[model samples]
Target: MTKTLFTGVLSLLIASCSQQDDRICEAVAKAPNTISECVHREGYLLADAEGSIRDVATAVVEKCRNHIIQQLLSKPENGPSLEVYATAIEDNAVEEAIRRVTEARSGNCKKPE
Candidate 1:
């Protein structure tokens, strides 16, 4: 019984230390800024046009539209600002990711600025 418990603990420790193939990480790695770029990457390949768009439980948009509305909301808005969206990646790395992603997302967000 002791041996079994020890093995289980060791397994848990190993799993905890292992690097996770996180989607956000992969997405950032593949394309730091834009959604289109990330979609072409391995994990994000599944992110291609999905369901329609919904507005706070309102009408829906065209079929197979980009379902990641959160991405759009990230644009620099003069309206109510929010800082709730953040990731755990290092600042430099995250900056790189944002640079890449934003480049691709160009013009799709808040008017060119």
Candidate 2:
């Protein structure tokens, strides 16, 4: 993406940080599996809009989801199922944070599929 487009996107995301955090957090807290919670959170994350921006965001989302799942899976004793809800909250927080950071960084909007 051009620097201007990247800047515009990042600016858009930075401007909207606080608004989406709560919803994302809630979704993350209740998710079951990494992919499941990710899928759920992703829906919440992309609650609006269409087109390549959404497509690019989806791509990054997989990475984000895996990152969360890995974190949750690391503690097998707790088991992903047992602690999924609480982890979802954290996952949401982390995801939102990632969105903000990515927006600011605004890497190439790689298509998810």
Candidate 3:
């Protein structure tokens, strides 16, 4: 019974995370500039606290970069040619996210623990 309860709780947690990701991604799709804030707020740190700012930034990008791109491409406004723009959009998002993280880190803001 304990195992079953744990599994159920885990499943709910996973679902909630996915839902949160979806909501953030959708917002990103509407406002590309918010990518950095969203990433910083919601992204999981792939680096230890000792890692450099750039390293932590890169890790943040690696976390949700794809999901943002996917959300952008999924928009109906883009239609069929959205795939053609995917590369450019992704490139911009990555750069923006990295830049944001770097700036935040430089401001003495602590990376998530």
Q: Which candidate is the best by lDDT?
A: 3
Error of 1 at 16 (Å): 4.0
lDDT of each: 0.33, 0.50, 0.54
Q: What does candidate 1's lDDT look like per residue over 1-113, in tens digits?
A: 99999999999977754543333233234332443333223122222124221121111111112423445455456643344332211232333333433332321221111
CA shift of 40, model 3, Å: 3.2
**Model 2 per-residue lDDT at 86:** 51
In model 3, the clashing pairs are none
Residue 14, candidate 1: C-alpha displacement in angstroms: 0.4
The estimated TM-scores of all candidates read 0.22, 0.28, 0.44
TM-score winner, 1 or 2: 2
Prediction-by-prediction clash tally: 5, 4, 0
**Model 3 reaches what TM-score against the true structure?**
0.44
Tens-digit lDDT track of model 2 for 2-85: 999999999998777534343223424354355444544454445443445445355546545665556655665745574675
Off by over 4 Å in 2: 1-54, 76-83, 86-98, 105-113
Candidate 3 lDDT, 1-113, residue by residue in tens: 99999999999977764342322222222223455555654333332345766566666766666667666756677365766566666676566656555544334333344
Instruction: Put the candidates in lDDT order, highest first.
Output: 3, 2, 1
Candidate 1 Cα outliers beyond 4 Å, as residue runs: 19-26, 29-113
Best by TM-score: 3
Return the number of clashes found in candidate 3: 0
